[model samples]
Target chain A: MTSETTPKSLRTIPREKAFYFFTSIGNYTGLSASSLKDFLEKINQVNIKSLEFHLNRGDFEKWLNEVLEDKKLAEQLGRLQRSNLSGDILRSQLYEIVSRHYKELTTRAAFSM
Target chain B: MKLKNNTIALDATDYKILEALREDARQTYTDIGEQLGIAHSTVYDRIKRMEQYGIIKQYTTIVDAEKAGAKKITAIMTIYTEPKESEKVAEKLCKAPEILEVYTSLSEELQIIAKITAENQESLHTFIANSIAPLPGVLRIRTSILTKKFKENAFSIVSDPKKITFIKETRNIERRETV
Candidate 1:
């Protein structure tokens, strides 16, 4: 019998708040993982500056395709990827795309309060 | 005391005294003087001078958050705003009770990092959603929920003179090794 695997494309309303949706995205997109989760749960906290440092070095296109599974976003990011933009420019681009995605995901009828 | 031509200077002794007090703010001037091999009156004078020069802001206690019933939840938010509106955004963030600290970055993206705390997760979410997101000039916000707190160093001018020297030597060796 084959084990069932959940598709990463399927967007589900997180049981927690919208903030957690970003954290889950971070985990899925390889920004961070369970290794840091336990420490944060117990007593350690992640720094935003450090997260920015890691995201600046991460593969945005891969994150959009593999984790978010958004073809449109992946295509947009892919174009920017070829431009060879500086880290700051790339970050702003990614932020805009992700912000749009977040708005769409949260606006779904299921998530409406 | 004047060092050379009209330069007010802090000597090694002053630094040592400052270091001792940093380790224990409640440390008596007599004890600090004894440890640093200076007179109590000298310690008092140096502290007074430092205070006058605005080097020493205030002596305060660092309370344990967990023990104080204040460790509810914490998150780091990365905020984006209009480049010219960053100062206004930062000021607004500072006025919010949930926000503990705010930092502005000098980048094309009007980036601000805010540390927020709340009594519970739901309240924290409400505060962000109802309070922060609608604020004028806030373009986008990305939040990271802190899972652990590995270190939070107290504000100090210098940790230890010996350690600072050692760390410098270690960094020099590391640089040489890499090269």
Candidate 2:
């Protein structure tokens, strides 16, 4: 199988899972999406979401609320908050959200944290 | 001073105060008032209210990396460790100064993701290799650094969409499961 099709690569991370994953990555690395694309890409290639579960251990929800205070993105995310989605879609959306506002939503040192 | 968590209501002025702080935290209340066309006292009041409501947290200075002569290395450190020792390992990492941030990822296949900052790449490497890698319970570590500085700043996602959304809905994707 190609790298993309491997079990580790092909598995899907649902929205909730993706939320945890991206948030953890953010908290740990201080990296917003644009800065950490290479890192995400590497993790993506491996088809693993270990980064999502472990790093988001602090007061992340509150921090998320503060940092991602975009009413619009919050609204869009709210629509999916209770609604369940697949892991892959969620992962993509997480990356999209970060990539979209990466330049703006993060500090210079955020990713390297 | 007392620290109380005040969860209360907010208004347009409160939002404006937050917006100002987000842009430049060092702006004086007088400067803020000049920009907002309000009295400095009014700006102070609004800011206090926002802080009371937990809307505005702390103010900080934004440092320019190029001018500071600090090397910015952004990496995703994937760690491998035994299942039982996860918490212990994470705790140990929390104490390490060079290891600024650590995240336990959902992709359990990799134990942790870390971001490191140092005066130079050599210090960063030494920190990761000698300091981080040698820690007990750490099995393997892989790292990648920023090749080019793209952009670093925060933007309001609610107000802007055209600028924020890049990966469209059609991309094929995958998710790594926890081990």
Candidate 3:
């Protein structure tokens, strides 16, 4: 979900706490996202290599859980981790989870207002 | 690690880290990463996943019981039980703290093999006579005291950690339809 539905304390993180993408060990793609919205965009732009690297290392879930304080996304990704999905299948599923969450948050924000 | 057909695939890095840790568990993440040429954070992450899967079961220090003045005697017990009661007997043995390990051999006759730990000879005999003999379907019993020491190799003992490629094992549970 986006920050709109997320608690203010966990809505958006500072630069130092942002999620960083890596192509592999010691291989940074120079891509980082400081918010869920930014993350959704960056996920599309970033290489599958970077996604695989971060997914294998569970970096995405760690960022979601530790920085964004979003357990829902973290848990959704955790289940995906077990699903043995990869490549575009993985990327699309990854995008779908976040996009669905982003939409969910946006809708909640709209209704709450 | 790569994903192939919805499974999380493990790479050499995970094994190398395990090999390093198996050689020495106290090695810091930084040390392993430096030797393996991966990011230290990656090393940490891999090990944590291994732990979650129970792949890395435990890190323990082997203690010399005799040198430490502990009256520990190891006994190898072979129990011949009725075929129908073999598993039951083995499971019962597992409940005893004194029973270190329980194994079943499917021979012509079902045999329960157990590694038993005891304080002294008298207790060992007492346990076998009292607890073991009284168990149902026990046809006979055999015991051998390990009188000497030998190699106990913790390393080099077991699987190749998924033939050098690890995969998280998941089982599908389905309900059977019964009339």
Candidate 4:
């Protein structure tokens, strides 16, 4: 998947919201036999520079805990917690979200914080 | 992953069918239908779809490595190469049947990770020293022989998530706990 410079509403959302959104996309893509191993392989091969950015575990964890109380995002996150989605699927989903919301994402870096 | 093969989506029903096939690929459509409460024709359709989509790639028997006198070893090979030689090395590695799975990780230590299974240490040694080493851009090779298979196939764990918890417990369970 290729990255987009124009960001979407997804990029403006905090890490928790972005995680849940991408996680859902991962589920939809990986229902078959796709695993994280396959997804990571795809990401590593992708030509997108912004797509190559890796999120820190500490940041992910912090965002996860904060959003764990939000019922809606939590529900989506719970669906992803099942560990059914492939890593490649999640990567693709993030790539899609990033590309789709490139302009929005780029314009508002402060929104993410 | 490389887009060399086709991929298909699988539903819950399809997963059940896959579970049965994993244990016995020779199972009759009627038997699977009976167990799944579906008609024989439906079973056939599902299997056909799986084949067409590449979910059920090829059904083959699992030969016992020890019983067949085939000393098995599991080694994680890390290949380092420049961008120019990536395709060349990947193409060459794909031709070797011993290599089962390959993944490119997001780590500095390794770029491409390959899992290889061989008959004996000598054969495995030759495979690494000769077949893999000769690749155009191969810069390094790190291999670890599998002393024991704590957990092998991902198919089992993926098909049944319960296996994950079971494996975790089994790994921690003491031998004395059984008695």
Candidate 5:
């Protein structure tokens, strides 16, 4: 099914759950050293209510593409469209995926250096 | 009065002094001392120590902006910034006359949260567009207009004795419920 046809339940991003996901990504990404620190910082600063509204309305991926101009990241986030997962579980899964991507990037950077 | 190196440890007497001063910063040390039954010199000493410890930043008047013919439209703006530019951006925003407070948020999507004030919505829009948007490293800004203000720095250092009693009674009720 198209992303547009995705159920509302799949799109829900709760505040505390979102907060956990964002903060985990921020910490793992190492804000002081990572190149995407600003991008992550921006994500961290968005009000919880605003983030919830955007995610609930399914504008999150669009916002990432348009504002952040990170289509790959947006597309990666788009993978979190499973209808069966509960909100908390979905958030945890999203956090794991993003954290893994950053972890790999961190390892690559360490190896390159 | 004994000083705790740099940071002064406040006691009941210190809290009473703070409460008195908060009520009226203009109140004389003598008046505060009289009210609290302490020596004026002791009150002065406590205040001086508190200031040194940065507990008391500055003494300033709280103005009724609307009554003073300066109506303000306040909005909370969430800002995204480039890596390590959040501090610089926050500092720049703070320097602007229209911005009231800039706070760093722990969220991943936002870098800073700034409270801005303008005479009207048009001015607020213009300031955000012209001044804030142009700041280097500022990636995005989302504003939410404040509708009502219930409290502004309303917490008291000195707790009301009645409230403390009420809290104790409530705790007993909560304990009973848990039991």
Candidate 6:
């Protein structure tokens, strides 16, 4: 099978199990993503406040580890969180890490299928 | 009194004062005190202390560079520098007017990310080839020219000070002997 058409088990979660973005404890940012690819995209448009909020709350790591089952990416993000980065720097760096991981994971999943 | 690390402790009142300043810096101390239910003199004293300690660096307007008739090409220049020379490269880059923002990202080694602005594509190319590449410890650079910006600095985000860790101010502190 082509990498794009690789088996479902080799892929990230579907739309049903998407992670949501939030600005505060109960304030949702009206954004959600199912797969790593989708999360990678939505993160850019989401407010830095949401990114700061989620990073501090361990929400992204939790969702990545639990819903996406990608502990490596989660841990990588965890390291960034501890670095005391905030604002657009956080967004850009977070994007760089997530995109790199997404590429590696997708390639690995394709081969493992 | 300054702490051992050249840092200052930010209490709830400090956070509230910061929040008020963030909302409208031009507002009078009396106005802030009225809103926060503190005396204007208290607000004045707190603000003065904050400024002296180097927390409130400067009160400046956040200009929309693009809208201000700046026909400059912006590039997200990500450069990987030798671990030991990271601080030197970053300090030099910080002094460059074209390089607006400089940040160190978490990677295998520290990576320098700079938001740069140039007059045109030719200038942008020249800048990378001439200015960036010659940096002694620079390993490689990846420049992503931003075609459009959906968002820039979101100043409206009122950060919670409780979660925010206060740290050392880079400015030289006038250390006074605490009695």
- Best candidate, TM-score: 1
lDDT of 3 by residue, B35-96 (tens): 88999999999998877767789998878989999978998888888899888889889999
Error of 3 at B135 (Å): 1.3
Candidate 2 C-alpha lDDT tens digits along B31-63: 989887889998887777767756666666777
lDDT at B41 for candidate 3?
Answer: 98
| Candidate 6 stretches greater than 4 Å from native | A1-113, B1-7, B154-179
Query: Weakest 10 consecutive residues, lDDT, candidate 6 chain B?
Result: B165-174
Off by over 4 Å in 4: A1-113, B1-9, B154-179
lDDT of each: 0.61, 0.51, 0.76, 0.53, 0.61, 0.76
Provide the lDDT at B93 for model 6.
Answer: 94
Question: 3 or 5, which is superior by TM-score?
Answer: 5
C-alpha RMSD between model 3 and the true structure? 29.2
From the highest TM-score down, the ranking of the candidates is 1, 5, 6, 3, 4, 2
Better of 4 and 6 by TM-score: 6
Which portions of model 3 show Cα errors greater than 4 Å? A1-113, B2-9, B155-179
List fnat, each candidate.
0.00, 0.00, 0.00, 0.00, 0.00, 0.00
Cα lDDT over the full model 5: 0.61
Q: Which docking category, incorrect, acceptable, medium or high, applies to candidate 3?
A: incorrect
Residues A4-55 of candidate 5: C-alpha lDDT, one tens digit per residue: 5532222333221222211210111111111233324434443444334335
Q: Which ten residues in a row have the lowest lDDT in candidate 2 chain A?
A: A26-35
What is candidate 3's fraction of native contacts? Answer: 0.00
> How well is each residue in B144-179 modelled by candidate 4, as lDDT tens digits?
666766754536614564664575578578645866
Angstrom error of the Cα, residue B79, model 1: value is 1.1
DockQ of 2: 0.02
Candidate 1 or 5, higher TM-score?
1
Q: What's the TM for chain B in candidate 5? A: 0.78
Model 1 stretches astray by more than 4 angstroms: A1-113, B1-9, B159-179
Interface RMSD for candidate 1 relative to the native interface: 8.3
